[model samples]
Target: MSPPSGATTTFLLIEHRREIADLNERIRNRRLQVLSLYGTPIVVVLTLLVWAGLKIFIWLSSDTPTAINAIFFSVAVLLAVAAGAQFYAEFTATVWKDAETPVRELRLELSLADERHILEARRHTPPPTDRQASYKERLPQELVRLRIESRHYRRMHLMMQWLLFVSSAAISAVTAWYDPPQPAKGVLIGLGFTITVITAAAGYFKPRERAFNLQQTADSIEQHATALELGISPYNASEEKQNLELFATTVEGMRAEQRMREQQLDQPQQGQQQVI
Candidate 1:
């Protein structure tokens, strides 16, 4: 079989680039839409919770009018309904599905043409002479997977930290404001216990540290890949095949380290059986 002409390869590259750009745009827009859909409702609900807390304090301190209480209750109910409806709408939305259809079709076309696979292999994989195409493809994919895992764990770490702070603050506020004979005191005690547990868990897990280490490893791998591609510094002195082999070995080492870290994270605490 004849090799593809330069012009044909260039045309295919342009077409794939355009398709990827369009798909990326659509995916981004869909993400924004989903965030907005959920974010607005969450903000509203939090505001309502704060307002309810304030109202409860007011009611306990003094005799709030029946009309005022009734109105507040009605508004709360309305807000809840609105938030629930928005959540339902978001759940039922097919925006992601619709956006992915075109992307899938484009991917299928590119795959059949064999252009996409070649381009990706060339861009991401080590030199063809040093590593199997499959191994090269796997390395780039593993890099992406690690990056995603790092981000996810980072977000979770931050979220848990915030929850711990918020729960602690809630306990403090409840303790300062309400005394014995009030139900709020019991709530405060419960919150305090919960916060203690969360603090202990957070300390033991050290998710932030794990996330940071993962991120660093991923960044290192990415830097090495980029340097190899550009023929810069450490990679520049070596022949192409030697550089490719070194790159593969370096990436494999990083991947092994990442796997070890993941295993440590998965390890059970003393007396606790690890759950898959």
Candidate 2:
């Protein structure tokens, strides 16, 4: 039987395939960078801040008063703050970037392609439009909007980073103006310790929270994908495989999250039952 002539199904398939291919390639190539740039520097800056704070605390807590104590203390505090700010900014940018829209939408496109391929494979009468669509496709238009939202969030993250950087730097500068590691290293040692604790706390929490969010989002996506597949023909081999892959990825993540949550719930419950 002849296929739909004016429907442009082939073109749709080709276009979507190319797009998914491009996105997958680009995403794969840049995955390392995205992971690295999004949050790694925060760790380094945090470490420095911690060490600096510890040094500052030791200096301030000591009874052996060095004449340069004030100056050293101030310098350590300022530098630690600056490091923290820079790390926070970078992390903010990273989270938004990781959470952006391409991840979901590209998979949806693959699903559309698969639907087309499936119709072709059925070897039945080809109609004007391919009616066999998987439930996996949530909505292309909505997905596009989500991608936009993701980028917008990324911009916000960038702004946050800058805010952190400038604010921390400014604080550091203020401390520096008051005192520097001028005449004696002992002056800054105690101040370093104090600054480290504070800076480390801020830096770690800022990005760690974002990581937690990503893990949470990943779990949500997994649930949606599973629900989608449950309503569809999973054995439809003629369809694109990418959607399956995406679903599989999310499913694994969800399973892990479920296990963790279950463990948390049972831990407390088990303790109570034991007491009873």
Candidate 3:
């Protein structure tokens, strides 16, 4: 029998989809920005390179020549590096767009729990049309599984990170080798190297950090959902508070497995846990 009306069940949830109407609030996949950034520098570098090559060709035919090729090499390397870095930033932002799914899944779990609580509180609503009640009952478990799946976003995140890396390495090597910056142009060459190094490092590591964070968050949320699906609500306790322990593990650290242990201790091992 249902509890006498208004006994709400709340499940923490993450929504898997983003549907915010405001464009500003929307998350963009990091890929688009990265393409632009990478592509732009490539374009700029190529133009300068071609022009420089033309100048070199012209110099060869002339009776006398100036140090035009040196200037061209100096400028081209700097521009290519700048573009690569810019693209890297954009690529990571694109990765962040994928973060929305984990957030969304968490939201969904919470929303489902809220529905469960509401249903418990209600007294005499007609049975949900057809299998709707059964469907609702199954939702909690499904939600947990869905959330667990979201944890892999980090894997995808890393893939994109590597993509940027390989591309950057190839580009940088080619730029350096194809047109070695001359020592007489030491100042310019040094500046170009410095910028390229800095940008490459940032682009490579920043998104990996974010991917880690997102995975951690997803794991925590999924664990919480699992406990709730089995009828263990941390909302009430002699269970004793642990200072948002779940959040700490999944959000800031790799504690999904630890969370599972904590939640299991909160629940029972003797009986088969209910699913659906």
Give all TM-scores, in the order shown. Answer: 0.48, 0.23, 0.25
Q: Candidate 3's error at 109, in angstroms?
A: 32
lDDT of 3 by residue, 219-263 (tens): 555666466445466623433223233323333343454345334
Q: What is the model-wide C-alpha lDDT for candidate 3? A: 0.48
lDDT of 2 by residue, 162-256 (tens): 65566556556656766653543443444455456546544533433343444455446544655555645443445445445555555456556
Per-candidate local distance difference test: 0.69, 0.52, 0.48
Which scores greater on TM-score, model 2 or model 3? Answer: 3
Ranking by lDDT: 1, 2, 3
lDDT of 3 at 140: 51
TM-score of 1: 0.48
lDDT at residue 98 of model 1 (Cα atoms): 42
What is residue 62's positional error in candidate 1, in angstroms?
Answer: 37
lDDT of 2 at 274: 65
User: Over the stretch 94-135, how does candidate 1's per-residue lDDT look in tens digits?
Assistant: 534443234455455545546664665466444466354336
**Which predicted model would earn the best lDDT?**
1
TM-score of 3: 0.25
